[model samples]
Target chain A: MKKRDIILVAAVLILAGGIWLITRVFFNDSGGQLRITVDNEIYGTYDLKQDQEIQIGTTNTCEIKGGKVTMIQADCPDHICMHSAAIDKDGGTIVCMPNRVFLEIVGQEDGGVDTIAQ
Target chain B: MKNKIAFLGLFAALAIILGYVESLLPVFIGIPGIKLGLTNLVIVFILYLYSWKEALLISVVRILAIGFLFGNLYSILFSLAGGVLSLFVMYFMRKIPGFSVLGVSVAGGVTHNIGQLFVAAFVVTNFKLMYYLPVLLVSGVVTGLLIGMVSGEIWKHVGAYIRKNNREKL
Candidate 1:
């Protein structure tokens, strides 16, 4: 309602500043890939855009393709992992919560976990 | 007592209508289940025009009915926690001199989001969800402003109605 109130609103917006620095330091998601392998193969690689697909067959055999790893055809019912896009940055994860699987990419810059693959 | 019950029923219906209308305005952001909380206007007005008990009752009924009607049972935990926390915050804030219904409403809006975010972190099993906190807070500020404005307007109208009715009675 007042000129000062306008300044206060602007100050709040500018100062909010994401509070993201705390997250970066606390999580320690700095440089380097969190390499992942399943069933004796390079099943998933993080922190890059390789976009590979990995297929697991019969719960015993795992195949890698497309530069990333995927459950391909998992025995799980949700198939939520299949819906995830490819991740290539820090905080990115390929999580199969039902199948007891987790793959994370920790890029130093990106805070978003984009893809949870099959 | 009968009059109070009738007034509460009317507030319940008003809350339901506002909740339904607010649901139609979606955030373009991909996050799910976040809302602007337009129904808060009724609760804010109740705190000043009625009593804390009545305001709290309205909050609970509003959230429960909205949750059930939308089949958002999975999100009920967040809604319940947020609704209670927001009401508590506003109830305490109402004690301040000149705080007015608008100030109480703003405080409630902010606290609601705070409570919901706390639940979200636990559900996802990852604290990374905290990154969205700032966004949520900013949204809270905007929605708070809107709710505050609406509550202020409603209070003015209600005050005018009471004055007019009193004059007629005399």
Candidate 2:
């Protein structure tokens, strides 16, 4: 490979690694609640500690078990949300773009309200 | 002139076919934007063979065709964002010295994902979508390298053949 090509590849790797480090250090935390949103509006917040299934607007079904939330079922054609990895303590997201459903792990210290800036 | 136009059409068709092939594959790592970016092979090749104008045209045509045939309106918007941004990046990268098709293609692939992420964030009205940056960047680089390698191989033989044909015609 050319010198510039190697540099280009190395640059991308380093940038990706840096972003990952930042996210792990700053964003990811042992969250207590899973925030579900539809079309940017709050749908509901479920506790990760409790095991339960939630149906969001008849388009998606989410399950919370063992401190992890997963899109157990979806009617979307791609089923991308269904295939996405479960979001847990380390703070991740599952977005079903087709259905406009978004599930995220947020550290809600105050169970009364979502004060987290997100 | 006719030959060049015909080749551009062929390239667009090939890109669409690659897009279809990619659709057949299951989503990788469960990430929305992560894919083989197989169609980029044609885009990179055409960029080197012709100019950004032709490359842009082919890219647009392929995205529109594939988007309508297999995807929905939302998908079309996302694809347009990614495709146009990547094409611009590749066009500029090609002008830099010592950076070959591999480098240009890598730039294209990574920027493509970034562009899509921006649109996704805007659509969802949440910047938290940036959370996927790390994974998307890594996937882009990996797929870009693979596509670039194949493109380089194709350019070696096809580029030479095309140049020879042009000289004979002249």
TM per candidate: 0.66, 0.71
Interface RMSD of 2: 5.6
> Among these predicted structures, which one has the highest lDDT?
2
TM accuracy, model 2: 0.71
Find the number of clashing residue pairs for candidate 2.
Answer: 0
**Share of native interface contacts present in candidate 2:** 0.78
DockQ of 1: 0.13
Off-target runs (Cα >4 Å) in candidate 2 are A30-118, B168-170
Counting clashing residue pairs in each candidate, in order, gives 10, 0
Worst 10 residues of 1 chain B by lDDT: B161-170
* Tens digit per residue, CA lDDT, model 2, A4-53: 99999999999999999998888665356899999999999887878899
As a whole number from 0 to 100, the lDDT of residue A35 in candidate 2 is 93
Instruction: Give lDDT: candidate 2, residue B153.
Output: 92
Predicted complex 2: DockQ: 0.33
